[model samples]
Target: MIHKLVTTPMNLVIKVGEKVKEEADKELYDLPTIQQKLIQLQMMYELGEISEDAFKEKEEELLIRYEVAKKKEFEQWEELTKKKD
Candidate 1:
């Protein structure tokens, strides 16, 4: 009974941490969020709020992230399809 009391709280904490990490990943790697960021960055450049070099650097980062997000999304879809079959 004592062991269960100790381990049960630890297990709940671990599950909560995992859920938080999953949510954070989804927000970070979300396709629409990345695209919106890119659009905002371009607007900043066009409006003279950011320099060409800075804009290019940020754009490249966003592009790379977009590609990774796209690949992840595709893989997730594939997994879902496989599960259904």
Candidate 2:
């Protein structure tokens, strides 16, 4: 028995691709959860979405949060590894 292949149109392919990207975006990255948000804010600043002062303030806040999260993640990983050793 021969199986026939169905060809997908370009528009359908693009729509499906976009939906897959949207679904993937819903899942959070494991490291530095706030990193993306920080970058987004930085980009907005670069794009002139807000004033320099406001951008600086938000950048500082996000950076501090990112550092704290990174440290906590490191500590937790170290503890888990130590247990295995």
Candidate 3:
């Protein structure tokens, strides 16, 4: 009936939002991926594949990106907590 029609669309929208949030969570809190990139940068520097300046520059960029990701993660956690309460 009308109730079913109304709730169906609402449910679909909620489910879609949940899926998007899950995907975002993966990208935002992906620590392992960040760590691997850091390791690669270190290896490149140690192997003399890149100069000190390049290494420092890349490392700084990566660290900044990690910081932003951590911020996003924190914000997302707070949002979820608020929703639960």
TM-score of each: 0.90, 0.60, 0.64
| After superposition, candidate 2 runs with Cα above 4 Å error | 1-32
Candidate 2: clashing residue pairs, number: 0
- Global fold similarity of model 3 (TM-score): 0.64
- Tens-place lDDT per residue, model 2, 1-85, is 1222334465678899999986654433234457788789989999999999999898888777667667767988999999999
Q: Which candidate leads the pack in TM-score?
A: 1
* 6-73 per-residue lDDT for model 1 (tens digits): 99999999999999999998888999999999999999999999999999999999999999999999
Would you list the rank order by lDDT, best first?
Answer: 1, 3, 2
Worst 10 residues of 2 by lDDT: 1-10
Candidate 3 Cα misplacement greater than 4 A, ranges: 1-29
What C-alpha lDDT, on a 0 to 100 scale, does residue 78 get in candidate 1?
100
Which stretch of 10 consecutive residues in model 1 shows the poorest summed lDDT? 24-33
- Identify the runs in model 1 with alpha carbons over 4 angstroms from their true place: none
Among these predictions, the greatest lDDT belongs to 1
Residue-pair clashes per candidate: 0, 0, 0
- Report how far residue 13 has shifted in candidate 3, in Å: 19
Winner on lDDT (1 vs 3): 1
Q: What would the per-residue lDDT of candidate 3 be over residues 1-85, giving only the tens digit for each residue?
A: 9999999999999999999998986765587787789999999999999999999999998898788778887998999999999
